[model samples]
Target: MQVTTTADPAEFMATAGDWLVREPVENNVLLVHALDPNGVPPGDREPVFATVTDAGAVVGTAFARSPYRMTISDMPAEAAVALAEHLAKEGEPVPGVNGPTGAATAFSARWTELTGQRVGNERAQWIMRCTETTRPVNPDGRPRLATEDDQDVVAEWFTAGMRDSGLSPEEILRRTQHMVGGQIANQRLIVWETSAGEAAGAAGWNPPLHGVVRPSGVFVSPNHRDGGIATLVLGEVVARALEDGADACVCTHFLKYESMLAVVEKVGFRRLVDVVEHIYE
Candidate 1:
């Protein structure tokens, strides 16, 4: 197997685009980057992209950059190990790796052997899908599109959500600044309001690709968690996306977040695959 590296998103897409869409759900992150207008080198920091080929046909792909853990797509175990060796040789300080269970496990193990960096933590993730959602019970508040006036608090909740999910501090800050505004401007983010019209929580979805839409994420403040805010907002967003022509909705969440699991369950998401995220020391 040969692993090719590139800093250009277009080049990377050109090389592995076909392989990526072949298993879109498993490669959702990469596909979103390829199909986005937010620019793939988010925060203007270039990511390390790897494309694996055997007999000159693309077989696998992965990427690593600061503020985000390395993530691999459907690939052979050997390809994943080869990617670990390639990253080690290039000397990128990958903070962690997350992806489909098999590739992530193979890559993390080889990375430990090659660079002596131990796996600091392993978080199991659930990839869930909703083809049709059950209507969420109303929580006294309704969902509305976020606007510029709501940017500050939305960014705040975005950061809080990232922190709660154990994202690195730099990542939380970067995404708060770079992503929140875009989400609002594109009308992709939703705000759940109180009966008095106060912002109680937020949720959003990516533009559909291959008939699939993935929720960017959802969050309700501590004081408002009891109101079922997340379920109501996310369910509305998914329902709207389906009405807008998306065939299905998808989301990835840590298994530890029981609240999120329950919220998703209330809206009819069923587990599709098991994912893993391994942190490095």
Candidate 2:
């Protein structure tokens, strides 16, 4: 097999699209394409690789970049080792991100042998799929579009969501602001409010794609934990997606979010897959 790298996002997306259709996952393929569109300049984006057989069939793929990270789609442990070895030899900086656990472990060992770097802590990667689409009864309030004036409040909630998910607050805020300012132009930030009109929960949506959109930043404050506000927010988000001509809405939450899971199920989302994220450091 031979591995070829490309900076062209179209080529990357073409390969990625095929991989996604063959093996669907929240983080591994879908979200990556949503975040980085084809035809766009690479910017700080990483290089993508397509592993091809001598007969000219694409076998597997991977992505890697500096200041961001590298990750592999589902592939054999041996392929992972070979890819890592190639990167190490090329002096490319390895990213501390996800891959299959066994593959990552094997590659890390190979990396250490080739580059003398040590593997750091490893964390479990969870991938949750949306199954059902139930809306909550008696939603506390209505879903409203957030305005520029609400930026600070939205930023705070975004930071809180990151903290709850064990992500870096600073990085979350930076990325949030960037997203909010860009392609998210079609997105609506929905808020769940109390009888007194106090905000209880919030969620964001990506613009619809192929008649589908992904829900993002779903968060309910601790005080609103048992209030079923999440279900309301989810319902509103799904409604918006439908109204915009979308057939389905998708989102992924860390497995630690039991409450969120319950809420999504209450509103008609069913479990699609359990995804695991492997980080390399």
Candidate 3:
């Protein structure tokens, strides 16, 4: 197995585009970045890209924006270990790694051996996909596209949601502004308001890449719990995404976020895989 690195986004895509496209949902993060390298969270710097090949065919891929964990796609255990060892030797300062549980386990173990950093299992989440929309029971109100005037409130909610999910303080700070700015700039941020015109919830999605779009930043305020507002808003979000030419809508949320899980499933999303994230400081 040989692992080659590339800094040029186009070059990395050209090398592993086919493999990633073949399993776009599984490689959603990489696909989104390849389409728009600036799409990731802020404070993300010094991108590291690697394509693992055996007998001259692409077998696996990995990416990291330094100071954060690496995200990797499915690969042989040996390849995963080699990639971790290679990155450590190359002086990569990664805070953690995220991927399928088995692959992350292998990579984190090897990384520990190489760097003496204790590996900590951070969280587990589920990757879900919806190919067909279930008719959503629209509640009392309509979905409203958030406007510029709503930035402050929306950013607060976005940041709060990140914090609630146990995202690191550094990550929450780094990403809040970009998350709010990008969502509004892209016209993807939305709010669900009640018949009384009270904004009960908000959610957003990235632009479609490789015919796949992932919706996130979904939140319903505490005053409005168990109202099916999230279901109403997210159902529309997923439908609009697919209608906009996305072949599928993908999402990954913490397993502990039962409300998100319930709403997504009710709206026709089927669980694809459970991903475990590991951190090595």
Best by TM-score: 1
Per-residue alpha-carbon lDDT of candidate 2 for residues 1-281, written as tens digits (9 for 90 to 100): 55666655566556555654455443334335434443121224455543433345555566665534456665666666777767776777764546555655666777777876665545554444443354455644666676675566766777776653233566667656765544335446777777777777778776655445677677777787887777788788887676657666666545566766676666666655443454444
Best by lDDT: 1
Estimate TM-scores for all models.
0.94, 0.76, 0.92
Model 1 residue 253 CA deviation in Å = 2.0
Question: Candidate 1 residues 102-199, lDDT tens each?
Answer: 98999999999998889988999988888898656575778889889888888777787777435667767667767777788788898988888888
Decide which is better by TM-score, 2 or 3. Answer: 3
Q: Model 3: residues >4 Å from true position, as ranges?
A: 135-139, 164-170
Evaluate model 2: give its lDDT: 0.60
Sort the candidates on TM-score, descending order.
1, 3, 2
In model 3, the Cα lDDT at residue 250 comes to: 91
Residue 268 in model 2: lDDT = 62
Clashes of 3: 0
